[model samples]
Target chain A: MSGIRVENLVKVWGAFRALDDVSFETGDSEFVALLGPSGCGKSTTLRLIAGLEFATSGRISIAGRDVTGLASSKRNLSMVFQSYALFPHMTVAGNIVFGLSVRGVSKAEQRERLARVVDLLGLSQLLDRRPSELSGGQQQRVALGRALIAETPVCLLDEPLSNLDAQLRSEMRNEIRSLQQRLGIAMVFVTHDQTEAMSMADRIILMRAGKVEQSGLPHEFYERPATTFAARFIGTPPMNVLDLAPGADGLVIEGGAGPAVLPAGSIPLQLGLRPEQVTFASAGQPAVVETTEYFGADTITACRIGRQRLMVRAPGRPGLKAGDAVHLAWETSVQHFFHKESGLRCEIDPAAPAKKTRVAETTPQ
Target chain B: MKASRNALYGGLLLLPAAVLLWTFTYQPIVTTFIDSLYSTPRGRRPAAFIGFDQYETMFADPVFWKAMLNNFIYAFATIPLSMAMALAMALLVNSKLRGQAAVRMAYFTPTILPMVAVANIWLFFYAPDYGLVDRVLQLFGLGGQNFLGQPDTALAALIVITIWKEAGFFMIFYLAALQQISPTLMEAASLEGASFWQTLRRVTIPLLMPTTLFISVNAVIGAFRLVDHIVVMTKGAPDNATTLLLFYIYQVGFGYWDTGYAAALTMVLLVILAVIALVQFGYVDKRIHYR
Candidate 1:
């Protein structure tokens, strides 16, 4: 209640629903990320919270006050935009103090806040120059400085580092996360990049088709995804999901691979395994290596297990190349099972025995 | 040898433009400066160099001074008025209003219409008794006044017409600049607790400075070059009240055959334009952000 909350938020544009029945709440000093692919209503949700867009039907409250009908100016929040949005004609100091000046803050107070933000952001020397004269990274810092100077209870960020290069993006990601922690203000950041969401946010709200698919901590999403979409979206190489048929003792691969021991069930299920979980072991399911990608410290080998493609991460170079035969294996405890009809993850029964047999007859050379 | 041949080829490519420019533009400017030092030739008399005499006569002419004053007033009045109206029009059309394309077309129609034709139409509007303007005034229960026939309102009426004709053309440029602005910037401003007017002042106007500078330069040049409306409507009438510098130059050079004095007046106009161009590019451009 002391942070930002949205209840039953729905935004419709004519026939298309941009956000539908979205509800979430951030605790005090929480950093929540709205994570989704493009066109999934993540940005729309942020805009609604920022009051930049009016929700078709919803209620938004900031710091225990209902601001649903209020204009953006009355919302008492600051935002950093993807474009940086620095005023081109204004000096860095001018841009940073613009909101304070607009709010009729005293000149000395404005100067004090500006000085603090300028020093915090390392923009003291650049304060006299206009935004156009600064590099992209510097401009991004100025944008952050502007938002930080507002010192509002809530801050919104719409993919602020998207315009920067990859190197700067990571650097700014850490910087923004540290700054958010130091300020201890509730921030809702919207980004399509899962890494940005996972590395920076205290909580990640993954959205799909204008609906919240899953909301949890980064490791929770990585370990126990709520749905297949969440499973595939959170990781770098993504989770490999293989369809399996219900068998007598366990679930057998729908294709040529042997049975995998999961909890006893009759319904067909999709098995999800992360690239790191699947390993190049001595014996298990038969698989043929298709290709391998080297990432210096690790290598991910793309292999075909029965007809499904699975990526197996191996330490350093596995020395495996395309067209090579190999065996893929993983611990049954680390496997995720999803219902085939609905893509939602299925929980394992705790009473079931953990014993699982490795059928060497199905193992590849 | 090869570099010399390449230079020769480049010179050949530039020859046509260089020749055309020298013949039409450079030659006339040089001839005008030369003629300004000599007195106009009369019938059965040859022209003679008089060493600043033509300039002296031009400086002494009261009508020339009046025309200079009128041009300055015209430029000062029209440029900012047209640019402001253009910015307003651009903002209106840029919104998500119904029939915006049609509205934009209607606003831009005046820009495409010939000034001579537009002035003819405005002449009827400014006519003394039964014009459209007088009809509107009568509907308001006020008596009809001579808009163009009086010295007080003549130049002002011309300035109004120039603003109307030029605002829409400049609106196109402003609209382009407005469209180029990232919509996210506006959203970001709103989230920063900026009001609509504050956002317009801090973000929209500042971002549009380059376009404004470009349009202002054109407006300044047009303010001096454009006299077709004057020719068709006022003909510098009402005791030379609406006589702009270019119109006076035309009247002297062609109507009175005072070519030498006309050349001197042309030099003054050129100097004014040069000064404006220099101030704009050298000073204003340094302040505006191009991107």
Candidate 2:
């Protein structure tokens, strides 16, 4: 009863279709992240679900009720805005109990809930301070307090940690996840950062151009992206999606030598490889190291495989320099195939390999 | 040497404005006070030093008291009504839609019109039986009375026109303030299950206090400073019912040729305005949220 269900949500602002037939659902007490780049309709979808914006044609339900035409307040949900949206004029206590006061709860009850939320977020000392007087993280905590005090069955957050520094962001991330787990309330958050989605969300709904590109468990998105877009979007340095050409035997890296990597087909294909999966080895696909970026723990090395460039992650500094000849390797079974034009994932039997040797991939575009 | 040369150049650049302020503003205030201390010579009496004589006369004048009362009532009536109306109009126009620009311009049109012209136009609307107001009232079986000609309704009529004119002026400021308020604040309030009136009372009004303070101070000053509409419309008719302080000052100064008393009256009006502005900024400003 406490889950969210959206079906065929379409939002058209004048002539521009902001959201196109987007749909997803979250199970009871589930943590889902609407993940996409800006203008990919993730926020639009969230706004629609929150009843902030009405859909052109869609159905939205919350807690087993049809809330498609309901107001945000009537929908029985709470939202933490990207800006935190704390009232600048109100004190910390006033902000937390705003909803309770609005709903005309008794003073004793208000005080009880306010005490619980204030103590939960450690805002009791700052109860009398104005929002302007609080730090960004404190203000965010106040926002969370406001959302949690309502005791709603579901909570929604819109890129809530984007305004904080990297360190505070990670800190709040774990705090928010643990809070959600302890509360056991359904929470759906939206973010463009794959790391945030992957680390915090139990499931991720990745959107592109107003459509849901892929939606499933976090590991599913990492292990098998349904499209080239999803594959490129889900990984850091992004996945290498290379053009595949008809080779002497089968399909090879476009414009490069092969023991063909896949069986031949008329429709051009692509091969996807995560940067971490492709590592340097003694004997494998040969590449020219173009550039190397050192990041203390690991380094990202850019190498040319045929006509396309591929990014590979090397643990610790690789001591690899620009223009260095290198061999790239990955488990042959780990290669991902996608249709070149449609960008849709294409399945190839793992047992039927044109060549048994591991190979690195090239850039798709 | 370079700094001294730069200071000289800065003083040279400030000369024109300083000279104009001294000649017209600071000098007039000083001279008016000086004039208020002296008795103007008549045909049989020579000019004599009579410090505070005109001030005492101003205190004793019943018409001055009536004008003061009329002005306060007018101020009390027009300020809140116009400000509330301004806030309402600002809130209404704040939401985006088709022809929003046109609606805003229509609301602001009255503010840009000359007060004298507006007064003249309002005169017909306040006419005895054939005026727009009377005609509307006539249909409701409450007509045939002159709004500006009677002592009872004259000030009230003037107050109405003042509100109609000033609300638009104040609305521009409120509109700007309303725009500066982030939309998410309102959204958050709505999410809290706050109704329209509740949100208005809690968030909108509290956030708008700084603008309200600024508008209120301006409205108070304008109540004493503006008398052009009075000159064109009522001229303090029907036993001085609509006689504002500035208008009374004008009449005594120009009609009676009593420049000395008029200067004293000017001092009184100036002091009242200053006290009001000071009280508003000193007392109310602390309570407002600036940013």
Candidate 3:
């Protein structure tokens, strides 16, 4: 197995900078996900490292060798495209053994490897079937078979699960993760779905607008997001970001009179709260319940404190309704602060916690 | 009553197309077949039936054999060569190159111009001493070549012009098919360590079989039916070297006014085309991947 390192990778398409000075590395056998929204340069970063496209200026080294100028084939990396891109005419066996055939491997070894991959991906019965005959999930497995059969040190996947339906996506997610673990090859996958990243990756690199916003362990994205964008992008019902107002005691909630959460500072600030973090507390900040969504396993209550709204995730059948009076609370450790103007995480005061001050309750509408 | 009236409405709606097809297509075919079974009507005597005599005569005729040979050569030579050239041209324009639209337009210009006009232009090109071909040859000290007047080169010369004119038109089809192929397929091929030629052979060529089948059928029909270039350029001169099947039919029917023999030849042409159609669809169509 081998690792990949991208140093100061910058790719510009004439006027648009698709990737801007992005840098990251993967350890051998590590599963890393380049996670971000659409057009966030996550895919571009993967393509650049894969040597599918040249960076305007940067260096990419794979397996401790500079391969920035090398072709994709020379880099010895396999890729599964978003469309699967299986040769429609070739049978499953042909597609699986295509890389070996292209490299002019011995026929006996080709057959041996073909058998091994077909067995690994459970594609034995599908060996004779053409790509068109296979279901979407089967085709996805064929694509995986094609990539894995190469036995490359690193494999790149571009939104490989986006085409699958929900049930299959989760199934294939675990399958791919386990496969990568079993193979012990360094793998990097790009996805806009945070759930895929958070659940599958050993490390998640959150990108935004051609730049790396934050990259660390999966929990780091939830525990300590480097920026407001990172916090908002990595969680379910994404973290709510509220603007802050300068209060007499400290920086208070932006629009209404609420507890000053941080020390007063001239630099404007914002607060990040995860939907799943907040819960209904009797002796908490007073707010009005605006809406409630009943999920089978949990209930999400939308609470309006001042002018901002944040979702409160509570376990099963909260029996909450709109126009109900409520007080919302979360652990002090869950509060995330960012510089409002720059959107970068900043420390207002580590010592001074967001001490809840008694406040008047608003009339329920 | 409702079902019968609905049937009447459906039949009424189909009448115009059915009438047009029968008049323009089926009726002429039937009349031509009937004519092939009899001798021509003279000024005094009416037509007399002759069973298979015209076919026997046609098979025995040397000119008819020569025309068949010529048409076969034309079809076999032009179909593969032009289809290959069309695919090559399509691949060329499909790449990301400068002045791509101009190059595509240039390749297709021959298809756009009238075949007679193209033939007329090549006619001058094949002319003796002052012709463009001879002038270029003179620069290499190989001048005074009479390409069309010589029997060996006459059919070959016309074959060149026909391929030049036809390949461009065929290229439009290949180009459309090439565009329909997803680019990610090529990317995946590259990632698999397949070189350009390997990818083209293993992936592109297999996928393009449907287009090839369609183009080949058209090419086969075009080869047998083509007479415009032969009419304008060679006119089957130099021992009737360039007389294709349709051109020979035109000669027998129009020049000699042998309508019965011409009808017999037309039947042969029709049978050849029908058999080709059946063979192509039956044998080749089964193997192709449509998607």
Candidate 4:
């Protein structure tokens, strides 16, 4: 197995910078996900690593050798594309054996690997069927099988599960992660979906606007996002931010609302709260429910308070109506603070214990 | 209610076009079929109908059989070779290389030139002493053979020119098909350690089969219908090597002033073309695996 190292990689297409001095590394056998929104350089970074796109500057090393200018075929890596890209005329067995044949593996070894892949992917019955004759999920398995049969040291997946439906996406995501673990190959996955990265990656590199927002373990990023974009981008119902000015006690929540205290001498303050972090209570700033969505296990309530609207993800059976009024509260430990201008997180306060605070998680409809 | 009325009005607007098609297109085909059985002259009305006489006479004509054989050879020679050249050209133009626009324009320029103009240019190029072919052959100390003047080489020369003329046109279809293939597929193939030829054979060619079938069908039909170049360059050759079915029909119709026999030959050409089209569809239909 081989690890990959990308150092200050830059890619420029005329005046536009698709990737700007992006740098990161993946340990051997680690599953790292490059997670970001559209136009965020996540895919560009994957291409650079795969040698599909040439970086204008900097070096990329695989297994301690610089492969920056090598062709993708010489990179000792395998990739699965989002389109599945199964050969339309080739049978499932043919597709699986293609990579091995290209590498000049003997027929016996090719058959052995092919049999293993077919058995692992449950593709034995469909080996004779062409790509068009198979279902979308079945074709996806064939694409995966083709990549896996090569047994390359590094695997790159560019949104492999994006084309699959919701249920299949989750199923395939688990299957892919398990396969990577079992094989002990370093894998780099690129996706716009944060949930996929969070659930599957050993390390997640959150990127935005051709730059790295933050890079760390999933739990660490969830608890302490180094930047505002990371906190907002990594979570569903994203982090609710409220700008505040330095006040005498701590920091002002709104203009005249209670002081949501920060550590003393904290500069450029902004408050961050997740939707689930905020609790609805009776005695607080009243918010009228704008909408309520029932999701069987849990109900999400969208409510408006004063001039702000926010989504609240709470426990089972939210007994709230569209016109009902409620209050919002949160634990102090759950709140995140950041610098207003730079969007970087405020200094950590190790001495402060977990404390409760009252804030309205609502926005005007 | 208003939407339903608008839909009805939209369909009613096409009725005129439908009626025009029925009168102009459908009427001619049916009238031609009826006229193929009779010995009608140009100025005659209510001519005497001689059932199957013209057809029997057409079947026995040596010229008609020769034209039929020539047409088959012309189609068989042109379709596969031109399609292969077209596929190669499409692949070259599809690459991310410098000056791609200039290269594509140069390759596609032949397709846009009129057939008559191309034939005129090739005529001088095939001229005995001062022609491009002779000049090049003389440079290599080789004997300059008369290309368009000999019965043995006339059809082959035409076949070569026909391939040259039609390859670029078929390339347009292959280029479109190549563009439709996702770039991600090639990247995936490369990352799987596939060499250039392996990727082309395994990934690109299989996906391009549908476009190949469609282009071949059109190329075969083009080979049959287009004898304009032969008329300009060889005019049925040093003896009769370049006399295609359509050209033979022109000879019988205009040269000998035999419209009855020409109509019978026309029916034969139509039947042959129809069979070729049906065979193409049958072959393609069995193998088309669209994904």
Q: CA lDDT of A47 in candidate 1?
A: 83
Candidate 1 C-alpha lDDT tens digits along A1-365: 45888899999999999999999888888999999999999989988888888999989999999999998878888888878878777889988998898888999999999899998889999989988899999999999998889898788898988899999999999999999999888888999999999999999999999999998889999999999999999897899888887555566666645544464577778888899987777777778999889999999999886678888988898899899988777776688889888999999742266554443333333
State TM-scores per candidate: 0.93, 0.95, 0.96, 0.87
The regions of model 1 sitting more than 4 angstroms off are A246-249, A263-265, A350-365, B1-6, B139-144
Better of 2 and 3 by DockQ: 3
Residue B43 C-alpha lDDT in model 3: 82
What DockQ, between 0 and 1, does each candidate earn? 0.59, 0.72, 0.80, 0.58
TM-score of 1: 0.93
Instruction: Return the TM-score for candidate 4, rounded to 2 decimals.
Output: 0.87
Number of the predicted model whose lDDT against the real structure is largest: 2
TM-scores, chain A, per candidate:
0.95, 0.96, 0.94, 0.91
Candidate order by decreasing TM-score: 3, 2, 1, 4
- Which number leads on DockQ? 3
Q: How accurate is candidate 3 locally (lDDT)?
A: 0.89
Residues A297-341, model 3: lDDT tens digits: 998888887778878888998888998988676666678889888
Candidate 4 C-alpha RMSD relative to the actual structure: 4.6
Q: Model 2 residue B4 lDDT?
A: 100
Off by over 4 Å in 3: A348-365, B1-13, B139-141
| Residues forming the 10-long window of minimal summed lDDT in candidate 1 chain A | A356-365
Q: Look at candidate 4 and tell me the lDDT of residue B265.
A: 80
Q: Please write out the lDDT profile of model 1 over residues B1-291, one tens digit for every residue.
A: 999999999999999999999999889999999999888999988789999988888889999999999999999999999999999999999999899999999999999999999999999998867998888888888747899999999999999999999999999999999999989778767776778798898889988999999999999999999999999998999999999999999999999999989999998999899999999999999978545
Q: Superposing all C-alpha atoms, what RMSD in Å does each candidate have to the true structure?
A: 2.6, 2.9, 2.6, 4.6
lDDT of 1 at B177: 92
Model 3 — TM-score against the truth? 0.96
